[model samples]
Target: INTGAIKSEAASSMEMTELQNTESGEIISGNLHILANSTIDNKGLVNVNQLFIDAETLNNQPDARIYADNATLNTSTLNNNAILAARNNVSISTETLFNNKNAEIVSQGNLQIAGVSIGGALTSAHQVINSGGRIEASGDIAINTDELQNLNAGITTQWVTDSIERIIEVQPEGWAHKYDVSRFPLIHNHNVEGQPFTDENGNIIRYFEDYTYYDYTAKTQSTHIISSAPAKIIAAGNIELKGNVLNSDSQIVAGQKLNISGGSLQNSATPGQKRVSYNGTRQFRDWDGNDEELDFGGIAPYSPAPKNTEFNLGVSLFEDSHADIKSLANIQTMTLPVVNSAMFSLVAKPTKFYIETDPQFLDYRDWLSSDYMLQKLAFDPANTMKRLGDGY
Candidate 1:
């Protein structure tokens, strides 16, 4: 179908095997029902009161649109590079769904997506870009998938805010146009006869049917996404995000409780390299009974010597790697064996309170006693022991 329009009444629904619209072709139906074995491609306007689609593959080109009051899709694969806007809800159930950069899936009420994966293809290593997928709704958004491996996507349930005041274009008479004033209320001043401005001879001089509306200029292009509605993302298996070193590059926020539960989530694609280095000064008493400052030589010298002419050191140590001593400085520190043994017993005994939720996971006691876990806790920068003692 090309360069024309197909109109239907509200009582009947149209069914098709394959729909290819181009050259500004238009389809206006009460309800559109499409069932294609391979693909249902659209490159023009598709306006329906309601839409239902079941196909193996579907694609909406960059210049195309599929607008409806409500839309429901069941397909194996979908590559939506254009717009899929619904007034009420947009529900999709597929094996794989990839919404490309600049693509949109907008709903005024609810948006739900259930699939194996979203955005990029599943892989072991994280992908390249930080952002690509776009999914937004004014109500709630729910996604249930095994892997949500997007390239730093931001899934939001926020209302869109226009950044600039756009010129309103009014279509001519005899054109089949859907009135958008129902969605956006208009503010205008009219005369006593319930009309707009009038001429000197008492003749009504009206502008376009729906007068021009004004949109205030905004400071930023981004939407006011800070106060959003409730959203849920349940990755039943695992989730992988790429190029998310910065927090703002990728986020999933809810207005109330943002519930996100998955088996695991990761951002780094490569294994981290382990390295540790230290530089400072140490004070000690030499064999000749003379107090001397031994320079370890990284940042500055140690001050206020400890007992027996030894200095107490507070160092930020990194485990899994040996400490690199830059200078040949003799290092010594007093150790309390009794305190160390007592602390370990208390920290390890409390592990029995945690039940083993999965057989694959080690028992709480065994995991807490592991060499890696112990070393990590001891050198944690956030002071894990302090938080634990506070019952956090």
Candidate 2:
């Protein structure tokens, strides 16, 4: 427009005689086109919130340019032949440019601009030349279908089958062997140092090359000593000893049963310093009656009598049979009247004698008679004469 000022309030179209620089400004509805070269000066803002430009009839020239600031361009159709051109510096912000169809450009010079927004897809069949400026969009930027297929065909091919066969050839053939202790000596015989030798199928094979003699004597002795050792005495049993029971510092008597009838047993003491004395009577009365018979079944009475003598006596019973009193006759003739009264009057005498006053006599009779000696003597006293040493 060759006017200094032109403004339109509503839908109106105007035709200009010659497009020229306006000092004030120019505004038009529907569309605005400048057929000649024009400059938009500083402090001159051109805002088109919804505007469309048609370059189909312009022959796509390189000399054409459109300068707008804080303006928007909304195009409805974007065909392959449609074009957009911007002159010098075009700073667009707070604006949007949408294209419904494709766009193309044929330019040689650089498009020097800043902050331009595109709101739709941009497709280009030919090359896009951006020498210095930046073009940004929120949507996809793609090439045309024919150009896309040509780009994909330029990629090189790979031989996947050959790569897979090479991988298979280099892979290991067997599984790993694990270490264990239960298969020790046998396992060590087959090993090459410490690692196990494996077959092709990953199974361990006995190679028998690394055999070294193992001193089993020391190992077996150590195990036997450990298993045979006794536990420490946390609490003493009923049995107590008057002196140190251990023979020496190196050995221990583990299997013996100690009987503490009257004294305390000392684990570490001098010969008689740590003596254990009788705390109570060795021969306890079965009941209050002193005439109570001693049961010789479990223990022999600690009384001065024959080995097989059973007495109707109590806690006043005699000491155990000593070597001096060797027989029943020796016991009967002793100075102790209690011994003769208890032995001769109360208990019957043994008809057969194995040995005189021998502790082995009871054991011998028990073994020979097979547990019937006590029963036979108690029930039938006359049976003693027939059996003799061999009880019936």
Candidate 3:
């Protein structure tokens, strides 16, 4: 029961039934193979410089546990339901550390804790890698880099949701500021309809006010047509859209060459009004007529855009075709002619398209005239009604 000196030279080949009351300080330098049921309990410590377990003799009945300051287990095969729990440091390396289809090793420290599991727990702090294995742990799973030469090694981890909650913090300071009104002082006190007027603190002050004007006789004239001559229109931050912009066939396309280098370009469709319909039972269906159905019932069903009803058209010039856009639906066709020394032209025919230009070209006015020309041709009464009636 109380062995002062315990040594197993060929312990890797032998089997251990039960190892108890080794509190006298037992030292195991060789492999400690547990072929049958074994338990090292009563707070007894089995100090092993190195340990090994045979893979062939592992079974459900034989479960091994070691309480030691530091222990190393190297094995090619492990039986099922083998629990190797260490109080301090535990190191294990095997072709596969598996037992009863589930093997677990746990190591807990003050600064960090590590574990590994093929079917169960195999814990270590220095290094842990699971190639084609699964690991379920409550603590962190990190690589052992002290002895490793390469820094970019692959590591897989499956941590509990509770652990992620503890590690990741959601601070108020991390919240992004949506709009900053101080930059645009003209927009501060302006009572523009539907334009968001915010104070210096980025808080919205006045929203869209729906008030119709009876005698709102404004200038109703077409945009100035400047032949084929180029013009320029620039903005500091962004170009936003509030209402639907449609062509003759109700299709929307890019008006001009838009460039925004610093700020983000976004497009958001206004949701339609919801209409409720009652089924036979108490269940009621709220249909906004905005849900888009995709036909993929043969293999699998996947609809990326479910609440999109309207289509969009985007037209970019040869110079501004590569701008970043938010969304693009079905593109029809594009025509491209070689310019300068650039190889192959880029063309896209999109049903619904959104383009984001660079901000650096905002103040640059070379593309503005082209934009105005396109807009004038797009909205002219003579051309507008014909284009709309033609069913683009």
> Which candidate has the highest lDDT of all?
1
List TM-scores for all candidates, in order. 0.41, 0.18, 0.21
lDDT of 1 at 187: 22
Candidate 1 segments exceeding 4 Å error: 115-131, 152-248, 267-392
Q: List model 1 lDDT by residue over 306-342, tens digit each.
A: 2122221211111111224442133222232322110
Candidate 2 lDDT, 26-141, residue by residue in tens: 34333343322222221211223223332211221121222321122222212211223221122212111221112222111221111123464332222212211112221111
Clashing pairs in 1: 306-310
| Model 3 ranges off by over 4 Å | 1-64, 79-82, 99-103, 109-392
Indicate whether candidate 1 or candidate 2 has the larger lDDT: 1
When 1 and 2 are scored with TM-score, the better candidate is: 1
Task: Summing lDDT over every window of 10 consecutive residues in candidate 2, give the lowest-scoring window.
Answer: 217-226
Per-residue lDDT tens digits for candidate 3, residues 1-392, read 44565666654544455434333544444446433344333223343434433332222222233433344444433332333443345444433323222233433321122223356654332322221112222222222211111111121222111111111111112233323324332223433444554544567854322111111111112111111111111112222221121111111122333232322323322222222221111111122223322222133222122122322322211122344555443432334323211111222323211232211112122434333554676654333222211110
Number of clashes in every candidate structure? 1, 10, 36
Order candidates by lDDT, high to low: 1, 3, 2
Which 10-residue window in model 1 sums to the lowest lDDT? 312-321
